[model samples]
Target: MQETRDAFVFRGGAMAAKPEIGSHDIEIRDCDVKYYTKRGFRFRDGCYDIQVINCTADAGGKEWYVEAFPMSFNVIGGAKGTNVYDHDITFIDCIASNNWHINGDSYWNGDGFCAEGTAYNLTYIRCESYGNTDGGWDDKSANPLLIGCIAKDNKKNYRFWSGAPGALLWNCVSAEPNKRGGNSDYVGLWTKGKIRIHNSSFVDSSKPLALNDWRVTPEQIANMNISVNNSLIELPEGKELPAPNYTVSNTVIRPLNETGLSANGVGYKKDMREAQILLTEVRPHQPRIEKEGRLLETKPLNVFSEKNPSGWYLSDWNNAKMKIAKGKGINDSNALEVSTNGSKGGGATYRTKRDSATIKFANFQKSDWALKMSIRTGSTNLSGLELRALTMAEAPKTKEVPLPGTLNGSITGWQEISIPLAKLKASASEANFANFAGFYIRANGSMAGPLYIDNVRLEPMN
Candidate 1:
C-alpha cells in the first residue's frame, strides 16, 4: 500500500481469524481506500472495541461473498461456535460512495456500509454513505445505532433488519432517493423488526420508509415496531408517508408540488442540495456526541407495567375464575393472579395494541431471545401450564410450549423462570408465527389454587 496525497491505496481491508486469535481494540483513521478487488474494509472474527474514523471508501468490489456482500466499510460476523459477533465497533465521520459489484446479483449484493452475519453493538456517527449499488447503510447488527448520519442516492438509503433489542437511529438524514448511478434507487429507510428513529429528516424521497422484508405480507409487517418521533419528512408530489402504519409523533410532513416547494416557500430540494454541498466538504457537520450512555446497548422488552398490567386481562373458562390483582406482585406491584374453584382450565392474555392493522411485537427471525417471568404459586396441583405466542392470521394460530415442571406442587415464593425462544413448539402443518398478536397463558387439566405471574419479559440471550 502507498500513501499518496494523504490517501492509503489498498486492494482491500479486513480482519479475520479464529475467535481466540482475533484482533481487538484497533483503530484505522484518515485513510482513503479505493479501486479494490473484493471488499473495501471488513471487520470479522469477533473483533470488538474497534474504530474507523475520517476514512473514505470508493470504487471497490469486483467479487464478493453473497452471504456478506462487499461494502466500503463492512463488518461480517457469523456463528463460529456460539454466535460469534463483532461487538463495540464504531465508524466516525466516514464516507462510503461509488462502490459496486454489478454483475454479481440483481439486488441482494453490494452496499456502502454493511454489517451482516449478526454483528452486535455497532455505532456509526456522522457518517455519510451514498451512491452504492444496494444500500447505503445496510446494517443487520443486533443493536446497530446511527447518529447524525446522512445517506443519499443509494438503492435503499438505510436498510436495517436487526432483531430483539433492535436498532436505534437519531438525528439522521436520508435524501435524494432514486439517484444512484449503477442501480435504481428504491426507498429511503427500509427497516424490519424493532426500530426507533428520533429527530431525523427524510427529504425528497419517493418512498421514504418501507419494509426491508421480502415477504411484504401485511401480517408479517404488522409485527414490526417502527417508532419515528419528531422528524421531518418531505416527499414529492403524490407521495404521502415517511412510514405507513408506524408510530410517528410530532412529525412535520411537507409534500413538494409543481413549484418544488412547500406551502410556506420551504424549498426542501434546495435544502438537500445545500446539505450535499456541506457534506462534500472535509469534516462535515455533525451533532455533538453527548454522553448518551452506550448508544448501541439494548434493553429487555418488559411485558408488564405497574398500572393496568400492560393490557393483560383474565379469560376464564370451565368454571375457573381469574383476575389481575394489584399490589400483590413481586415487590408489591401489579400481578396476574388466576385462581380456580373446582374449574378445568383458564388463563390470562396480553393483547397487543394495533397500529392500523399491524400488530407491533417481536419477530423471532434474527437473534436468540428468551422468555422470562416470575411465577409465585399458591396452589398445590398446577399442571399442564402452557405459554403461547398468538399469531396474526385470518384464522390465527398459536405456537405453544409447556412451562417448566418446577412450578408444579409445593412451590413457594417467587421463582425466576427463563425459557429459550426455541422451545416454542409447533407442528409442521401449523402456520408459522409470523407476527405475534399477543401472548397467552393457558392451563389445561384441573387447578387447585391461585397462580401468580409477574415481571414477564423477553430478553436477548447472553
Candidate 2:
C-alpha cells in the first residue's frame, strides 16, 4: 500500500502502531513529518517490509530521547525504536537534519538520526544529512549499508559501535561544518565495526577516518584484510601518522642490537674483521721497515698499473723512477709525465695512453672474491681504469673493462670502491682466468693530469 503523509506533525507518546498489517509491503513517499516531541517514527510493536523514499523528518525543537526519562532524559531527536521490535528498513534519497534535544534549562542532547535496538538489512542510499547538535547518523545495530551518502557540517558524521558487521561505506564524503565553534569532534567516519571503504574520499573533515581504538588488539589487525587500492587519502600537512606493522614476502628484519646473520648462515662480523685487515695489509708484497726503524705503510695496489711499467712493482718507486710532482705526506704523492703533445698536468691527464697492460701475479684462479680499490681523480676531467684477464699467449691483447666513475669531490681524500665477485663475473662474461693469468689496468680519455689510486685488494668471501 502506498501512503503519502504530508505535513504530519507528531509530539510525544510513541506513534501508535498499525494493527495486523500481515505480509504487506508499505511505502512512505514524498512525506514531510515535523515537530516530533519524541521520535518522528517509532516502529516498535511490529513493522516489516517498509521502505521510506524521498521522505524527510524535522524535529521542531522537540526533546529527543533514546529510551525513557530518569535513566536517559534529554531532547534526543530523530527516529527512535523501529516501527516494530524488529524490521527490515530501507531509506532511499531521504534527509534527516537539524534536530535538537533539551535537558532542564539548557539544550543538551541532540542528533540528526539515531537507530538502536534490533535491525536487519537496513540500507541507506544517496541519503544526505547535516547540521545537528550530535552526530549526523548514528547506528548501533547490525548489517547496515550506507552507500553514496553525504553527511557534512554535522558535529559528528557517523559514530557506530562494535558488534556491528556488514557495514559497507562507499562513495561517502563527510566535511566540517561551515561555521565557527562547531566543535569538530573525533572523526569523519568513526566505527568499531568491520567496515569496507571503497572508492570513498574522506577529506577536510575534523578527523578523517579512524578504526578500532583501545578495544581492538594487534592480533585483530593482523587477521583483518584491508585492501586499499587507487584511493587518495590526503592528510593535513605535518600530520603524524601512527605506527603500523606490516608483513611482506621474502623479507626479514632484525632488531637494532641483534646479530644480522642467520644461525645457519655466515655472519657479517667475520667479513668486517677481514675487511679491516685488507685495508691495512698490501697483498702479495710484505711491508719493508725503513732504516729509521719505522715500518713504512705500502701504497694501495693498482689493478691498472700498466701505465707505470717501470714503477709498477718497484720497491722504492716513491723515491725513484716516476718524478713526484705534488708530494703530500710521507706516503701520498702525485706522479706525472708530460705527453708528447704538451698535455702535461698533475692529474690523470698526463698519464700514459696505453689502452691496456698486463700485470703478472704469482698465483691466480677462478674464485668468488671481492675487489676493493680507491681512485682519486684530482682533476675534473674524466679518467678511469680497466681490469682484464690475460691469456697464456705471447703479447696477449688486454680487453678493457671500464670501472665506475670517479668520485665527485676533492681528490685529496680517499673513497672506497667495492665490486662484488658476481658483478665482476657479469661484467667479464667471455674471459675465464681459471688458474693463473695476468690482469691489466689502463688509463684512457682526458689524460691531461695524473690519477691517484690506492688500496686495491681482492679477498675471497667467507
Candidate 3:
C-alpha cells in the first residue's frame, strides 16, 4: 500500500476522501492488508460510499485492521456544523484476523474492525474475525447491520450500536472464549438497541449475550423490541438461560448450517455454510459469484418462517393445476406445485397474507432488490409465466414500470431467477411496501405441465 500510494500520490496525499469535504465511491476486492504500521486502510473525514469485498486485513502491527472515521474529529478547523458522516459504507465477504497491536502508542484501540466514536449506515455481510485484543467488529457507529457474518476466538465477537434503537442480525454464527478458550471470559455479541435476530447459531463463548436477555431482571431488560426467531444455541452445561419472549422458537446443540467450529483457535476462512435462510448471504466457499461483487444493499424478500404465515389462500388451477402439497422443497419440507397437460395453458395465484398474520417486507419500496427463487419445473411448455409484486389487482405498479417479468417456460427442473426490484410496478405509495399486497406467481398462460417452487426470497440490490 505504501509503495503503491507513493508511486501514485496525487495533490491530496494518500488519503482518498476528506469525507466532510466530499464523497467518493471506493471499491477494493480480493486484496490483503498486513503488517501495517499505523492503520492498514484508513477512511476518514466525511460522507463516503466505500465498498470493500472479499478483502482481508491480517497481522497489522498497529491500531486496526480496517478503520473508518466519521467526518467529525479533532482537526485544525473541525467538523462541528458539518452534519455529514461516513454514509453508505459496506464490507462484503471480508475478514480481519490477528489485527491487534501488542505494544504501541495506540495499543488501546487494537480492534479487528472498528469505528471509533459514531458512524452510520454500515453493513457487514459474510465477514469473519479472530484473535483481536478488543473485538471482532467494534461498531461505535449508528445503524450498523450484520448479516450472515461470523466471529470466533475473539475477546468480543461483536460490539454494535445504532443512533436509532435497533440491531438487525440475521443468520450469523459465533463461537467465542476471547481467543483464549476460557469460559465467561468473553462476550459473543454486545449490543445497545432492539434486535431482530433469526436463523443464527451461538456457541459456547463464555458469556453468550451481554445484552438484556432472559437472564436479566425486568429492570435490566433494555427498553427495546427483541425478536429472536428460529435460531440455535449451545451453552456450557448448567448455564442454560431462559428463553426470551421474542424467540419465535429455537433449539440447542444442533448443527444449524455451521461448521469449522471447534475449540482449536483458527482464523475466519471462507464460508462453507450453503444456505439462504436470511436476506443477504455471505459465504466463504462460493464459486458462482466472486469474493467481491456488488456492494449494493441486499435483503431477503420472502421469509417463509417455521410455520406458514396466515391469510394466504391457494387458487384451484384455472389453466394450471396448483395445490398445497407436502414434502418437496429445496430446504424446507413443504412446497407449492403446478402440474397439467400442455395443450391448454393456465396458472395459479400466489399472494401475500392479508390476515392478521401477514408478514411484510422492510425497506421494500425504499431500495431496489433482486427477486430470487428455486423451482423444479416438469417437462412442459408453458407459453407465459409472470412473477409480480404489487397491490393493485388489475393494474401493475405503474405503466412505466411493470408488475411482473415474463418467465422462460421452456426450461425444466430446479432453477433460480433474479429480477431487478426497480422494475417492479405499484399503483400506490411505495413507502412501507409492507402496506402493499404480497408477491404473486401467475404461470401457464400456455404450458404443458408441472412447476414446483420453494425458498422464494428477495435480496436488496442497493
Candidate 4:
C-alpha cells in the first residue's frame, strides 16, 4: 500500500465523507500491506464488527524518519465524553513487523498493534507481532482478549491499560525483547487495569512484569485483582521481579536461560532489533497515604489548611522551588511560597492521592461550590495566573480559568480568590468534578518573583 500519508483509512461516524455511515461489518482477508509512510491499516472510532484475517503489515514508516506515528495496524477510538467507539473487532493469523519511526528524542513510535481509547471487545487469535520500534501490543480498550498470540523482539511486548472488566491474555507468549546498548529489555507486560493471564509465557525480558497507576482510581485499583495462573515468567540474570501488589498464583519465575521458535517459523530471538519506544528506567515505588475507609468530603475539603505542605507540590520543578513555612501567609499562617526561574511551565499543584475520592457536585441543586484560596504575589503581573481543574481520564478533560482582575506589580498583602464552580461548569460543561484529579495554579512564565498561597480549600459560597 502506498499513500501520501496514513494509508488505508477506515473511519466511522462523521469522519467518513458523503453518507457518513460508519465503517462497520467489514472484512479484510489475505491482504499484504507494506512500506507505508504512516499507518498501514487505520481504523478509527465508530468502526465495529470488523475482521482482518490472514493479513500482513510491515515497514509502516521508514527507519530513522523524524515523525511520531502509531502502529502499523491502529485501532483508535473517539474523543472522551463522546460515546462513539470502535468495537467487536477480530484479527486472525495477522502479522505486523518492522514498523518504526525516529523523533530524535529517546522515545518515538511504530507500534505493531495499538488499540486505544474506549474501544471494546477486541479479539486477537494466533497473531504475531515482532520487530516493532514501540509496543507490540499497546492496548487501552475497555475489554480485549488475546489467545495464542506471540510478540517477539519488540521494545515493549504488551501494555494493557484497559477500563472496567479489564483485559485477558490466554495461552499468549512474549519473548526475546529487543535490548539496545546492553540495557535491560523493557518490561514484558506493563499493566494498569484488571488483567488475568493464563497459560502465558514471558521470557528474556529485563523486567518480567510491571504495574502502573497513572490516572487509575482507587476503586479500580482495588478491583484490579491481577491474577496470573499457570504462566512462565522469566527475567534476565541479576534482575528480580518486584514484590507485586496483586496475586500471582501458579506462575513460575526464573532467570532467562533459552530461546525458541514461534509458530510462524521465525526464531523468537532471531529478529532482535531496536526501535523507538518510551524508554523509562524502572521507577521506584511511590507509597500512598492509606486512607483506610476515610471517604472524601468535598463540601468542606481542606486541601491545604494544614500547617505543612503535605500534599501540595510544585510543577515544572526543574526550574522551580517550593517552600512551606509559617509566618509567610495571610495573617501569618502557614503558606506555600513558590519561586520559579521564569520557566515556561512553572506552577503549584495539589494532586489528589489514592485515598481521595472523586469530587462530585452534580447532586447539589445550587451551583455555588467554589475553590477558595488566599494569594499574594510578588510578581509583575497576575495576568498569566490560572486555575486548572484536572480530571482522572487518560486524556484528562481540564478546565483552565484565568485569575480575574490583573494586578500591575504585587498585591499589598493578601487577596481572597473565590472561583465559582458554576463558572467552571459553564466553561467545561461536561466537567462536574466527578473525576476531579486535582487543581493547578499555573504561572505560565508570567511571574516575576515568588507567589505565596495559603488556605486553599473547596466549599460552598458563603
lDDT string for model 2 (176-233, tens) is: 6332123334456666655555445555543655655565687765443322222333
User: How close is every model to the real structure, measured as TM-score?
Assistant: 0.50, 0.40, 0.45, 0.53
Model 1 ranges with Cα > 4 A deviation: 1-21, 60-69, 79-82, 179-185, 216-219, 236-239, 242-244, 257-462
How good is model 4 by TM-score? 0.53
lDDT of 3 by residue, 1-462 (tens): 431211111111111112233345777677776654344455544435667778776654334333421110111110222233455567778787765534333333345667634245566778777776657777766555677788777767776654344556666777763643222236787765556665676776546666634465675463544455556665555654455533445434433334544322221233545323322343221112111111223346453422244455566455566666577666546777766545555546555544222322321234655656667665554335665654533333422222222234555556766665545655344432332344555553555555667666667666
Worst 10 residues of 2 by lDDT: 68-77
Give the higher-TM-score candidate: 2 or 3: 3
* lDDT, each prediction: 0.63, 0.43, 0.51, 0.64
Clashing pairs in 1: none
- Scored by Cα lDDT, where does model 3 land? 0.51
TM-score quality measure for candidate 2: 0.40
Q: What lDDT tens digits, residue by residue, belong to model 4 across residues 285-346?
A: 11111111112233565557635333334444545556676778766777877666755756
On lDDT, the candidate that comes out on top is 4
User: What is the C-alpha RMSD, rounded to one decimal, of candidate 4?
Assistant: 13.5
Go through the candidates in order and give the C-alpha RMSD of each one to the true structure.
Answer: 18.8, 35.7, 23.3, 13.5
